[model samples]
Target: MASMNNATEGQHDPATPLFDAVSHPNSLSKQVTRFFGLGQDRIENILPGTPFQRDVMDCAAKDGQRAVGHVVFEIPQDVDTARLAAAWKETVHQTPALRTCAYTSNTGDVFQVVLRESFVFSWMDWTSLGLKDEVVQDEAAAAVAGPRCNRFVLLDNPDTNERLLIWTFSYALVDTAFQERVLGRVLKAYKDAHDELPRQLETPDSSQATPEEDPNPNPNPNPSRILKIPQVADMERATQFWRKYFSGLDASAFPPLSPPLTIPSPDAQAEHRISYSSPIQRKWSSTTLCRAALAILLSRYTHSPGALFGVVTKQAPMLDQHQLMMDRPTRTVVPIHVSCAPDQSVSDVMGTIDAHDHAMRQFVHAGLRNISSTGDNASAACGFQTVLLVTDSDTKRAATWEILKKTE
Candidate 1:
């Protein structure tokens, strides 16, 4: 089995000239040339998977790969099933990332290989099953969340005239935002084909369009080009910053979760129930408020002046221009160290969180660099004793907290 250390043995720093030339172009001319090349046929490229993807692959190797997101939508009675299927095929034809699959080597290296030949995604009609609405929904979720080798699946409920689309991919390939865009494109393509609209929607050519004119655009037209992971320019400096920031922190700085819970046996299963409401009006943002509360609670529990935790963030801007244009997933979770002095007020902690949040880009870059250097599992908490996940409510009026403990 490949380990983190093994993966780093022969790899060079991603910022090197050779790496940068293939991954990130320094000049507009170079980007233009590469953009055109991506549109060419007979091209086969394997993109190095991001650190986040690498971690997910490692976990999948042990626990089995499952869907990260599953969703279902009601199909209109007027919609034609044949047209919908055609639309889906067209959408997949247009989206290159959808056709790619993760390939892992024995040495722990992972790549997203663009398949030379595309296959139609799986589709099923569950109307004949005579299952209840609730049952169908549950099955849809499970179909995607369950172990499967494919990246995506689509199911249709003809009796209820509803469609359930279930797909799973590594977080490295598509984040929430990327998924939303894809869903939108699929719907638009379906509507256009169904209505037989004469309007022509041209794919945005990065070489021709200016950033301001094409703020939100589809990915590169070519399906075979592999997107590269972004790396920091000064990795050494970023590393020094993290080292200094965490200098005084020890293992006990952030202790384990209180009321220790035992791991379930292999045959045993666990269930979770979650409920959340909008936040009451506060001076701090929802994120700051949550972090402040967490810091205070940790201080009270651990009897320490500070708290350390991992915060998941989508560092989209940190990606290279070509990558940003390609609409790839770049979410990363980084360790955050916050101090709560006895004399400090809640507002003080909020300010601290705000500053830390602003500087998170650097932290993420540094953390990934460290992982690549040490061949450490990027998915591991990387010594973060706790994790804080604050999710937005459906109405976007408030947020909910999901705190997790990292187990070895």
Candidate 2:
């Protein structure tokens, strides 16, 4: 195993060994720690839990662990197995966030730790499995969704030149945007490796080239600096703010769409889903319009002039310098209060939303924690219910409807 001393200077501990037991055989654990630049003395690097990560951990604890994101792609016929594997290995090596694990302290505090070791990447050839493509895809998705660990699985169908690459992580570890970025990097790495192979084969002295002498190196010189988890002090003010904001709010303010069915069946049932999209004028942001529309709809449905619903927002960049360091789902979903009078125009509602948004941002800037496990539990104890989600993309507006329910 490579010694910790071999790591890049100024990045890791100098005296700490790479492995706790020198007698231990070369194992995945050692490889993980060495690759991640973790000191041997410290088994793991502790990170303060964000509200989003805490909620996800709590849910995964109750429900079986499931992957929060996945993507499938086909590799070109010309891409060799060695090149693909190399590309994947390089991607794993370059992205440290892919090697994290979550755990709850004995005292009930949720946290995430970098797995210094025990990192595993699997490449399976499913061509001989005698399964249909759909079956294989289903199995692949299940495998990705089932694992509690953070890792990547690459499934290849040798005969068909089809590849299924599943990158699964705890919701705390990644979000949709992060998943997209990771997919792009993995594809780019594969292309770079594929493009370099032909050049190597053409070199007259290629055989003389050594692994250590390879000219190409990781493009990111300092991957460790990518993400800085927020410290307790950083979130203390925000936490207090949110705790007080949701206080005294009716827990049953949002009600379910329909009464629960008395009979329960083990068999799966088909679910119906439909989505429609339309463009919005550039003068009005999609979020503002959606918020206003939702306020009106919710107000009429509930027979209330004002409604409170949760809105997911990215964490403030002021909280961390490396805002995009980790692809994890760090977004904070907080309850927002919206009011629409019977005579209020859409424009008026938009203005109200804008003002509310500004105030919310300011509150967050002033150290308002939107959601905490304790705060959420307290709200639920008081009958706080989640009613709806309004999401706005750059060019389109979207909304999802779900039965209102209290947090488990």
The lDDT leader among the candidates is 1
Query: What C-alpha lDDT do the candidate models reach, one value each?
Result: 0.49, 0.46
Whose TM-score is greatest here? Answer: 1
Q: Give the local distance difference test score of model 1.
A: 0.49
- TM per model? 0.61, 0.60
List the candidate 2 regions with Cα displacement exceeding 4 Å. 1-45, 62-64, 67-72, 115-119, 127-148, 156-166, 194-233, 243-252, 256-281, 318-324, 342-345, 358-384, 391-408
For 123-233, candidate 2 gives per-residue lDDT tens digits of 667766543453444434433333234554556776876665544455667765665555556567766765576222211111121112224433443433322344445
| Each prediction's RMSD to truth | 10.5, 13.0
- Worst ten in a row by lDDT for model 1: 398-407
Task: Give candidate 2's error at residue 124 in angstroms.
Answer: 3.2
